[model samples]
Target: MHYRVAVTGLGIVNPFDGEGEPNSGGVTDFFQRITNGQSAVSLYETQDIPRPISVPAVRCAAFRPELRLGKALSTMMERFAQLGVAAAFDAWQDAGLDKEYCQASGMTEASGVAWGTALGGLMAFERGYRDFWQHGRERVPPMSVVLGMNNAAAGHISIQLGLGNSALTYSVACASAATAIGEAFQHIRNGRAKLMVAGGSDATLAYAVVRAWEALKVLSPGDKATAPQACRPFHPERAGLVLGEGAAALVLEDWDHAVARNARIYAEIAGYGANADHMHLVRPDQNGQVAAMNMALNEAGLSPSELGYVNAHGTATREGDPIEIAALRTVFGRHAEQLAVSATKSAHGHLMGATGAVEALLTVLALHYDTLPPTAHLDRVDASCAGVAHVRGTALRGSKVTSALSNSFAFGGSNAVLAFKAVR
Candidate 1:
């Protein structure tokens, strides 16, 4: 028998405040700021680079993980894992699954963790390299290996939450987090686990990482004045994507189990579809995107007309934005003209592996509140992206959004789409 998967809780460690201050309001504040069309992207400069390159990007400037995870626990992990653990803890608490409550209820063994990150522990490794190459040090940090591993986030979350079922990690470029969430949903739906923490975290703001992206010529250019408006998806003059670093998590529980515990249901994770282009390593294919959307809609038993909104994977890249819009047009046909579409990356910047989780969380909130967050900084929609009903300038409130989809198309041609429905 297949069980239903429900999203009971949500958490995020994002640059929601945009003022170099800590965001204490968790997911509630995240939703409000996103809908209000705020931009967290800012001009960031590399300290270690000799030339000191500056670019428009989003960084968790105020994320002091030591405060959230405690000094001892935080010291053992790198920034990626630290962000993941903090987000997971918040989601666990939001789900009402405290350690005492879980132990008393015997819910530990049936729980698991699935996380994603494309450049896990890159910061830690960079520090070690700087010490050895720049400072001429012979020894690196003792915990470097453990802290720099890709699975560190999942392992820490699993241990902290007393989850024994499984602790898995995915590193599928930008699609990593969406894949993690999709697989976690499948695990619960297939009766393998009753509850799962699914999310992704990425911290690739290291000098080397930023330099590599600069080599690709896909990063948006900005100084202090233009940084906040650098990522304008669907806009005619949109330059390119802005890199970001953060984490977001969702608590996926079996429907019956959550109902039994009287957990607050945020939304139902109705379907997930994952596939690859198999054509190009970097370029996105319209066929692959359309196929993924069709698969998700089929699994959800939903038609094109039933999906009220689409959180597009609009990276603001010229080629990428047009292809994604074309795919949506093909999949939705005539309904494409009416379906509300927006890309939150316009506000929060692209979080690499963590982008999907953050956007998915926003989509869930959109369904729950019946409000559609706009694509920030979209002054003029490109003609190629004109078929869809773009949400711009400000949020659309009280629209009765019953179902929605979140799309994640990554650099390696991997595509993942998640379908959700309001619990009401």
Candidate 2:
């Protein structure tokens, strides 16, 4: 936790005007919208099964669902594979790493990738499945299985980035990306690698998947009529969350290496912690979430009051949102009220595996701009978020955020809390 790692450049291929804009759509835009009392969830007319929150899902700010990977990777899984590759390239450029060869050198077999995906290659598999049923093995596509592996996103990232070190994909429901980042941070901090491209990508808006969520009774039902009223995190009338797609990448550098190259520093990786509750799969657990947050705080040698803002894991679900706030209160106590909290999920829907890094990037920016992002659809506090300053409707200015925490709680009780600070 003492070692210093700075975030130099950032690259995002998210939905809402993704990379640069008055409000980059993807996750940040998602959060900002919810904070502004709006919802990106519209009527997804393409798959009209009814329901309002069933709007067209978050398309990548960078790629259309039909976007091809161009040259080498024309495989059926190219959509996901391409997004992961493009996001990595964006991070490289953002970090000012030379495409000719800002080159990642000496990457070992143990070099880390950590691609986070809750659902992998559903789009490809969906078509593949039908083809298999219709055309039989003659046209099943030789790479069907490979593309469908839950680890395809991470594996493709390694191959594209030339990551000779370590490669692994996490499928821990929604908290996948956050877990990956925590691991990537550990690798660099421990002298395992010089830099790591860490993040997640999800392209699973297939009919079957949506049907699964619908069966679980968590998918938003508020089409255009009251879509904004749908994913209202920490708000009273909030129903549930919308689903989205994105791939936000971050370049994690070794502290010494970053300073040696004179790279622009964004924020320091102060602390990280992850834990599993084993309590329940879908239901929320306040204790496990709080424990992870406390562990990160302790690891950072920070007190609850020192945390200026919290990037809450506000999924806007009936169970998850309030449980997240309860965890905050448990960890911050009386200072919970003083701490500002915002739900990126309120806007972005749930990026599943991408939420952690996406929200972590926003937290770093909050420290940089001194303006905490708001929890868009937060009109009235649910009983759980009653005492906390869940920033809503508008952004707060001149916040002295010396430190902040980004929380990611996923299904199966996977929880991760990352503590960050401005690079002084």
Candidate 3:
């Protein structure tokens, strides 16, 4: 027999707030924060990097600057790792019974960490090169390689929280974090383990990475002084998405297990569907995306019409925004209009691997809060595009959506969809 997964606790470290934000911020809070002038995007300041361009990036949740990061943490990994650890513990404590909730959730002291990332510790890698060319390998830090490994975020969280079950990292292009959340949900639902700290973390606003992204010709080429409509998800002017970083963690618990302890239940993770297009490296395929959504709905024991909102993958890229619309048309058909559709990238920019997890949490919060967050900066909807309203300007209120979907499509044609429902 199969079981369901519930989000009992949430810990988010996004650009909108500090790492310790209560998981209680549902759609309204999230939308309000995004619209209220909170931003993670900024013009980077670094030496030798003149006129350093701005990118949608963040360094959220961490041991405060006073905490003193160790040499073990390359500069890149310091705050980034701290963010994961802090957020993980915050969620652990939030899920009722602190260390006591451990056993109730079926988590052994050996509980694992499911972490995701688009690219891990890019700055650490740069440090190694700077030392290699400038100083020499002899002067390079001994722990540089370890710090830059994709698993750094997970390892740090496991060590800080002392969760020992199994700790690993997923690096699936952009879908990495969403995949991590889904896999962790599967682990708890299948009785593989008790509690899992799953989400994504990344800090890629360095000189080297930004310049390379500039070469992609997908980023905004216009003005940096003005925010160039920070991430225009579905609007025609969307040249490409602004890459951002951060980590969002969710605590998954067994149904009967959580109820016995009188724990707070936010929503149920009824279904998760993941697939790859194999058609192209970066280009998304309609059939694959559509299939993934259908699979998630089927697993959720729901029909297309049941989904009230779709947290779109809407990266705002020319090909991406439209392709996702086509896929939605195939899956939701005429009901697509009724489904409140919004792209969070419009507000916080593209968080990459952590994007899906962050957006998933927002959607789950929406179910609990009975409101839909606005997809800002979406002033005009492409006339011929699928009419999901493209949610723009301001937030919407009063919709009790029992079920919803958050779509994440990553590079390498990776696609993932998560189905969530409000706790009854």
lDDT winner: 1
- Candidate 1 lDDT, 137-170, residue by residue in tens: 9989988999999999999999887888899999
User: What 10-residue stretch in candidate 3 is worst by lDDT?
Assistant: 60-69
Residue-by-residue lDDT tens digits, candidate 2, 289-321: 888998889878898878899988887777777
Clashes of 1: 0
Query: Which of the two, 1 or 2, has more lDDT?
Result: 1
TM-score leader:
1
Error of 2 at 417 (Å): 1.1
Distance (Å) between predicted and true CA of 256, model 3? 1.1
Candidate 3 per-residue lDDT, tens place, 1-424, comes to: 6777888888766655533443344334554676443444544444553455655444443325234334444354544565565566667777764645445545555367898888786677788787787666667677677767778889877766667777878899888888998898888778776667888877766667778877887775434454536577787677777877666788887788778778899999999899989899978999999998998899889999888888888877888888899899889889988778888777777776778778887887878777677766777886545567555676566777788899999879888899998886
lDDT of each: 0.92, 0.73, 0.74
lDDT of 1 at 187: 95
Tell me model 1's lDDT, rounded to 2 decimals: 0.92
Question: In every candidate, how many clashes are there?
Answer: 0, 25, 4
TM-score winner between 1 and 2, please give it. Answer: 1
Q: How far is candidate 1 from the true structure (C-alpha RMSD, Å)?
A: 1.2
Better of 1 and 3 by lDDT: 1
Model 2 spans > 4 angstroms off: 18-39, 47-56, 61-71, 74-76, 100-111, 134-139
